[model samples]
Target: MITLKNVNVNELESAAQSCDFILPIEQTAVWASYQATIEGRKPWGCFIIQQDEKPLAFISLIDFETHGYHYVRSMHGPAWLEHPTQELETQVLQALATQLKQADKNLVFMRVDTWYDNLAVPVLSTVPYNQTVIISLEGGYEEILKRMKTRGRRDVRKAMRECPATCMDETERAYNDFSEYYEVMVDTGKRDGFVPAPLSDYTDMLGALGKDHCRVFAARVDERVVGWSIITMHGPVAVRYYAAMRSDAMHMFVTDRLLYAECCMLYDLGVTHYDLMGIGNDFAPSLKGLNVFKTKFSTEIIPVAAGRDIPLRPVYYKALTTAKKLRKVLKH
Candidate 1:
């Protein structure tokens, strides 16, 4: 049953708003359109799933090809309007599987990173994510500070006293000019032992989203850039996507001030939630430091369902899983 028929990217507002887990920026059409603008990759599509003429789910797929086989990745979605029963979810997954198989004989697998917790259909594999942190910006600035950890509040006070934070000009030049911020991001990635995105990628992302949807905040100590962040404000939520700080500025608490300033900025613009992005599941060692920093100001931790891979071609799926295991061993 095509409960929802031929729902295009432009027609995603109603579907996206129906689901609590699906943020406005995370709408299938928005991401698929952005991906298409990029140079590489395969065909992609955006669709909405409905029940009883009411939108229930939204998914965007990228038909990636490798070794003569095609696999679909539903980016951060198949987000639901509400908690789905196991039977309902299974039927939806099966319907999707049948549809993809008939559309492309070479299709081997469909991978989904479901949002929220539900009994999704069993899959070949799962990708885990740490619980995420979010802060409600509804109570206004003073109420926001009142919810922060005592130490966090103290640091913010110190940061204000020592080094103030400010948003750069909300102009196209600041958004496109990645020269200064890119350097800090590289240094931060090396210090944190993670790879940073290339300058071209940021340029492309800002260009696609435009200055109205994205903004950059910078912290300074006596005219020197100490910390910076790139945030996206879409729908009702604002996410601090990329952030970096100078190693020397850590003790100065520049990062704290930068984050607080951004929250205020978003609040002024009527955004109600601030997502600190990904964090450890339970203060795990891997992200202990990062988690500690975000937890200080977070209202709660939200655990979203991770990615799962379902096989359309069982034999090829086995081979792919085997290769993945082998690669992991080789890396070790």
Candidate 2:
């Protein structure tokens, strides 16, 4: 029989590192702290799945309430030490459901966006999904650069020679220039036609992640911040969690140069893998431009598992689904 035990944040983080999972920034305790501190979403629930008292997997989740129902979400996790068999995976899911329902009588569902793609599940995903590019930082700088596409290498060299932007890491300081970063992100969103998160979210992120797990960098030209990158590290992997470059910076290729420099910097700091997180899959036409830019730097396109929403209260789940559909239709 599978059992789930509640774990503290440190235990959760340690398990993730020990397992060497390709955890997204969202899945870390750093992110949980940020969500709690900034978004008022607490207390974080970390669970360890066990069989006969031996730990099998670790999962960190958060509680969210909508329309008078509470739910749990685990982003890109329950990472297993060894890949679990299909039967074990299903058993774990059922255990979680029984445990969560017992803990919170109002719990309606549990949604998990897993890291392992092949893990089979009984239900389809209720969340949007995207593919991401992973670049191994295994070798030296030259070797790493050599692994990029020829066009990417050319662009990096050209950008390095021509752009001449200054890079600054502000990980040690509180992110006071979030307004400036948000401004650039807004401009980028407008040009790219995607909505940007509010400035406060970034402020919370910086505050929560702090210097140890997070690095905020800026590319400056003429003393103005033209591009920014918010990078987060978990275990040996680092993700470019959020980045934005002004349109003018794009013209001069400052964005490319800054990104290359940052990757090198992270490599030197002992990060073994870097993710240019979230590119469009074959299904997303809108992600073409973004995909083209990121794919140039990637050695591999990683497939994350499909998200699954397991309903504790089937009637409420059906009602919520119908409500969401109706809302979308009415808005349109």
Candidate 3:
């Protein structure tokens, strides 16, 4: 029997660090790395899948009142990837829905853009809200790069020639994008209204992910860091979770160069694809340039569905959504 319940930070650690279904996105380090960065998080429903009292799957749920929806992150495989079948998936999804349905009424529905490939469910993109990207590692690094359009290689080379950089290996004493890497991100986020998670979130990550799958790359001029990239590994994918560069760094193509270097490193490590986390082409007009840039290297666009929401109590869902909307207007 699969029993579901809320998990603590320690329990999250167990699910994230396990060897069976271990992946970077699920790693406590990767999640905590973005701690202070995102806001409006609810912690009650980070559900763990257990079979016979042993954890076998892990998934997180967030109740977002702005849209009156619940977002499900990393919703598969607290167990071995091969463990969940079509029937079990249905059961698990239903079970997860039951948990969220009990929450406030504001939750209109559940939108689950899970870790599973966009291809896994062909019709998912047709849903109300969704975003995702596909990656390729089928060929070795050289081959993948060769597959790139000319501009892709050109930006990479240009960045390399001008960027000052090196890898802060995961084991390198201690450093973080939230602290050591804050400047570049700050400059960029301030340009918008974005804020990252607090610093303490990353402190928890260092202990959880260990040194094997996390890294921070800083682009510096002389001794000054102009930009940095924080990335984590999950299975065969090396995801670029956060990145930004200073005015000079951006012009010098330092940020792009850093990513190119990561691509090469990932290739050497036998990792196949480098996921440039996301480029909200649909919502972030300011990022149109980046969306265009990422396309130069990516072979295809993978659409991810919105995280699904199901409130345990219909009334609570209504109230939550109303409160959320009111709060948004007040802030504005």
Candidate 4:
């Protein structure tokens, strides 16, 4: 049997504290780091899955208002074993659809951005489609880097030679550089036709990470800033969460050296695997330069298989996605 209910802050926090996979985004640690911490108040929940009343898994989703519509963020979970039967996933999602409807009878639609593959269930009539990335982190970072093309290695070395960079864990004031990083991200997003996450999101992450759970690594050119990346550590995995470079100097490979340093620090921190995050595969699926940038420092590209979206109300899901596309257009 499956059940979903909006629990209180204490219960929500307890379930997260007990999670086994240590999902970097979904874990309790991140909520504090980014200051996006949630309680049973407003639109937040700890949806539980069980077997004979024994909790088998939990999905930590943040129910918040975005652009005036209800959205759910998968901080982590549907946490499960290596492989669960198709029937099991169906039950999980059905429970979710029921819960989402209960929470927001007035809520038009709810969106979940999960970075996990195969966790999606066709039984979920509430989701239209999932958009996100899930990179595998099952090996040592250096060995993965070695698998990159010869050109990738050269850029890594070139970035090292050209930039005077210093990489380390984040400090209280590290977010000051978050601005420089965000600027370049905005520029990149515009070029690619997407908007970047707001500054509040970074601060929320920092507050959630506090000083102990996450680290921000940066690259500087002669006391002038060039590039930066954020990594969150949970269990044995280190996720390359976010990164950016100075628009003018990106061609100089500062981003490469910055990543190399991040890998080294992860090794020092005793992490076994690193997540390269996301890469798009369409039209220019094998986009030479961007692919070269990430693969050079890592070889493993975990195929995210395919995504599954469940829509509780098929009609609403269609309208929501359409409205979303139109909204993006009006913003620009």
Find the 10 residues in a row with the least total lDDT in model 1: 115-124
lDDT, each prediction: 0.70, 0.76, 0.56, 0.58
* Best-to-worst TM-score order: 2, 1, 4, 3
What's the TM-score of every candidate structure?
A: 0.85, 0.88, 0.66, 0.73
- Against the true structure, candidate 4 has what lDDT? 0.58
Error of 4 at 88 (Å): 2.5
Candidate maximizing lDDT: 2
TM-score of 4: 0.73
Q: Which scores higher on lDDT, 1 or 3? A: 1
RMSD of each: 3.4, 3.1, 6.7, 5.2
Q: Model 3 off-target regions past 4 Å?
A: 1-24, 27-92, 99-111, 114-129, 134-141, 162-178, 281-289, 330-332
lDDT of 4 by residue, 40-115 (tens): 2143566556767766665666555645555454534565534456677666666777777776664544344333
Model with the higher lDDT, candidate 1 or 4: 1
* Model number with the top TM-score: 2
User: Which pairs of residues collide in model 2?
Assistant: none
- lDDT-better candidate, 2 vs 3: 2
What total of clashing residue pairs does each candidate reach? 0, 0, 41, 24
lDDT of 2 by residue, 10-87 (tens): 787776666654455676667777777744356548887889977788788888765576778777667677777777
In the range 1-332, model 1's lDDT, one tens digit per residue, is 43534566656656565454554475545556555666545435667787776677777677766566777877556767676776777777777877877777777888876542343334544334537788888888887788777877777777778765554533354575778778888888888888987888777777777776777778766666667877877777888877889887777777777888887878888889898877765523355566878988865677765566778888888887788789899999
lDDT digits (tens) for residues 78-168 of candidate 3:
3333445556666666676666655543444555544342213222122222343435656675666676668887777676665556543
lDDT of 3 at 237: 76
